[model samples]
Target: MNPVDKNHWLDGLEASVERHLQHAIYYFQNQDSEVLLKPSVTGGWSIAQCLEHLNRYGHFYLPAIDRALQRHDGQPDAPTFTSTWLGSYFTRMMQPETGKWKIKAMKAYAPPPNLDAHAIVAEFIHQQETLLALLSRARRADLTATRVPISIATFIRLRLGDVFAFLIAHDERHIQQALRNLPVSQDIDVQAVR
Candidate 1:
């Protein structure tokens, strides 16, 4: 991937986080437990499961990001962020638009059936807020120099900017999956929600 201005990159990511947060507030919060737990017509995971899955990831990445930021506290922010080859590969694989292959979730991250809709939605909202704050804090740190370990493999780490990119893309992928599981009668306007 080409180098991107740090501020511009963060701004785009922040906007994405805001949209996800708003959707959780306006849409998911309004749904009843039954609707939220309803499985897709093709027999996929429920909305609640999708969210819980994301929440599980947030449980790992959020703290990892915080720790990385703290460890690199005095570092200077770079003018631009250039994604590493591996980082770019991971980000592209997580993106819903570019990622056509459906990868199975790790056993730990896979959410089971019968999750509480309200709690899942609430946690998701909290995590999104936390992500926003971290993104803001990241302005003071060097995106290229900082590294965060991937949940799947602790020994391997990616640039802070790549972590943000892939993590948000993963969130979007599942959120869209969750939206698909929504009942047709609910008449959700996905575009307008953002």
Candidate 2:
């Protein structure tokens, strides 16, 4: 693991998130043979499908956050979740540490991989903007001192202090999964001219 400074965790999260975004764009933009479609891998979702899965969380959960935040009578009383909350399912899957004794289910809520790709991509940007806006509008202390409402999992809430980092780590996990699905080696003749 690369050594990261504890003091500037938000900065580190932002940097990693950007790098992951760059790679994800490249992965999707260029099919490059196996990347676009490969069923050989066991129980693997195609890159397109993976992108779809990633966006499902954003499309569904971020809006839920907005809705929950809106329900507050006072200033942004961060979110409090129960076992029945839909967002909790996603927060667990996209969670940073795996099986680290988090109060999340091992199960994933898979949406059908049939959404329009362009629309999904467009909405992803909008979702990110919405999240950032919510964070930006929050008081600095809320982002720092605020921890995620569910304590059974020990997950950090997106206070200004932790929001950026959480986004970055969340993006990184999916990015790596997409990369791993790519074929390790495809026989190509370098000697022959293209």
Candidate 3:
């Protein structure tokens, strides 16, 4: 990915987070547990499973980001964020554009067959709220200098900006998948989900 203005990048990510939060509130939160737990027509994960999967990721990345930010040395925020090669690769891989190859969730990240939809949706909303607050706090830290370890591979750390980009992209991918699992009658405007 090309370099982008730091504030611009953060603002875009914040907007994405807000959209996800609203989708959970307006759509998922109101759905019946049976609807959320129904198996996908395509033999994929159910809506509740998708959300629980994302919540699992949030369980890892959110605190990782918070800790990285807390440890920041009070350096001035960078004017621009340049994605590292690996970071860009991961972000692009996570995007849910049509025809993209699906990546299987690692065993640890996979959601169980039966989950309570209400709890999963509530947890997702709470995590997004936490993420929004963290993003606000991030404006004071150096995006490039601060590093967050990846959940899959803790030994490898990426620039904080890249972690934000990759994490949001992953969220969007799964949320889109969750939307697909919805009954056609309850279908949201697909574009709005993005």
Candidate 4:
């Protein structure tokens, strides 16, 4: 087995996410914003654009979870995977493998003309910190019981033990994409997560 597999899955993922975030913070701190924000390829999101999209979408899981947590009220009970039409769609979305969906969605984002890399990185850090706060407050039981907002048949193969695992993977997936989309940043090297 890979050394990564030996670690509890979400624990390994959380460590990776922290490392990735450190690289991003350092990159933004030192990088020349104009160069990083400049359009790299004709048909792609620029670094600033990619960062904006990640900032917006990485919280996909947390808002709903926060609502549930607020209502959790210390009872042994919490909501199950109840499917509203929108909820079903949410489930379908959160169910994809390590960002197969995120890449597709990222392709669809175009940065507005006025935004700068500085704004994008600032937004990214703010959003990531919010997500980390949510995760820190999440109870372990919540992690296990939170049914993925998905159909069982879809998840049976992965049988993800909890929502936290999925959320951690979600962050890492987008972080990887943003790193790839970034035009070279100041001396920092953010190798793609293997």
Best by TM-score: 1
Off by over 4 Å in 3: none
Top-down TM-score ranking? 1, 3, 4, 2
Candidate 4's residue-wise lDDT over 34-144, tens digit each? 755665455555667667766655544456556555654474632222223443343345543422454355433435645677867877777667666655554332333
Quote model 4's TM-score: 0.61
- lDDT of the candidates, in the order given: 0.91, 0.46, 0.89, 0.51
Residues 135-159 of candidate 3: C-alpha lDDT, one tens digit per residue: 9988888888899999988999999
Instruction: Supply candidate 3's per-residue lDDT for 161.
Output: 91
- Model 2 residue runs over 4 Å out of place are 1-7, 32-37, 64-108, 113-115, 118-122, 125-141, 145-167, 183-194
Q: For candidate 2, write residues 131-187 as lDDT tens digits.
A: 555544432223333433322243533333333344444555555555666666633
The better candidate by lDDT, 1 or 4, is: 1
Task: Give me the displacement of residue 107 in model 1, in angstroms.
Answer: 0.6
Q: Which residue pairs clash in candidate 4?
A: 91-149
Query: What are the TM-scores, per candidate, against the unseen true structure?
Result: 0.96, 0.53, 0.95, 0.61
Sort order, lDDT high to low: 1, 3, 4, 2
For candidate 1, what is the total of clashing residue pairs? 0
